[model samples]
Target: MQDRFLADVLANRHNRAILERWDDLALPDAWLVAGCLFQTVWNLQSGRPPEADIKDYDLFYFDAGDLSEAGERAVQARVDALLGDLGVCIEASNQARVHLWYESYFGHPYAPLHSSRHGIERFLVPSTCVGVRPGEVCAPYGLALLYDGVLGMNPLVPHRDLFERKAASYRARWPWLRMAADAATPHPAA
Candidate 1:
């Protein structure tokens, strides 16, 4: 994999601390994998002359089990406190996932963490579920690492479908989350 432009931007104190320390967390292995992929892609995209830029770090948690309100709140509070201590701004959506945005005047988490189902296979191991962004016109530095020792080219934008057979065998998860989410609310009789 190549080192992305975002790496340079996040190389600062706060982000560097968070990125380096994420592995130490006892959260599921999938969390670590997803976080790794997100960070890698963000770093790459941030450096390029972009059609878009990452404004905040988004962490999407894909869990098959339904969490209770108390459980969710506890998790969010813990994550928020950890981020606060790191001097980073953290927020969570109604879904109970954490979103870490850069607090520095010029820092941002521009890259988004999008996830989908791994199907019937045993993806419960946190290290399995990973996110992938599309390739730019010209390959970014260290992009090869994203492939993780594989010889292939992925066309999925913002995220690629690597193991389709596995994804297909099981139920479809997170089908259109990004598509349904928008900045605007419903129009009034327009």
Candidate 2:
């Protein structure tokens, strides 16, 4: 078995079937609440025959809304039902929305976001570049499953410079939630 095969398996039609079934309902257009939309599923196709049938599934989602509890819970329920139907042996906590287990063919951990109380912050991944610097990329932002919705960085927000500048003044005012990243303007994604 090759990694290509595993990856292919994850990308196979069956996975799509499952996702489609999950989508039968009106699920928010994001996965994990905030990070990146479900770009593509990651297959666990390693070069091992014993694990050929086993492929890991990776789903992504990002914050596109300002803040909404109803939206987060709706998304979380859909994900939970899908994973349950797949018979995934997941370890989930109501206190924390992080779920990880080993029942699927691939032993990849799945995070079922419930909500974030304090909300989350976004950062650059330090890998991709969208402008002048070819080697520069946005850092990985932080996400928390608190409140009745997922709270994380808003990727679609204003430019970093404007955001950083606007957020800087609050740092001295609010010590607990310091704005360590560059200051940017405060504008909600439309």
Candidate 3:
């Protein structure tokens, strides 16, 4: 499963380019994350080009020592300079600082994250929660739901309204993706 998923994500040339040059960025514990990884696989499974409908690349890094907005902007500037020519937006976020602004922006309180992986775990859909860096893939929840095109609310972030909004956006693009009604009932953590 890991090998196949790796191959699927790398099929997007921009993902490949970013991973190849990832060492150039000095951000700590950084991982290329979220929509860019899952959506590329979705696009491929739908027989569309791997890069189709990809809005931006998300890069998550943990910098607890410097949680200021300016610190995040500095990292983003570095990301832009390195990957700007790719002609796609690359958004770099400091996972450590999410708690400071999350409640105001997303209207939900987010506790401080211990690591970038912790932040990844809070994504609205477990199947869509994934991250990658050179030589590594961080998918705590396996790929079955993603491969099956199943959309379920993530237990870690079980907000009905937010999940509905997010799932609707995804289903809008890939009408074939199925939403499991029972998935909202909490189960033991995966």
Best by lDDT: 3
lDDT of 2 by residue, 45-134 (tens): 122332223223333333444234455466557666766566532221121323322115233333433432212222111111001011
| Lowest lDDT block of 10, candidate 2 | 125-134
Score candidate 1 by TM-score against the native. 0.36
lDDT (Cα, tens digit) per residue for candidate 3, span 52-78? 989999999999899899988988988
Off by over 4 Å in 3: 182-190
Residue-by-residue lDDT tens digits, candidate 1, 66-163: 34556556656766766667644443322222223211321322222333222101122111234322221112223333233222222221122433
lDDT of each: 0.33, 0.30, 0.88
Ranking by TM-score: 3, 1, 2
Q: What is the lDDT of residue 84 in candidate 1?
A: 65
- Each prediction's Cα RMSD? 15.8, 16.0, 1.7
Cα-based lDDT at residue 116, candidate 3: 94
The superposed Cα distance between candidate 2 and the true structure at residue 150, in angstroms, equals: 31
Q: Who is ahead in lDDT, 1 or 3?
A: 3
Error of 3 at 66 (Å): 0.3
Ranked by lDDT from best down, the candidates are 3, 1, 2
For residue 90, model 2's alpha carbon misses the true position, in angstroms, by 8.2
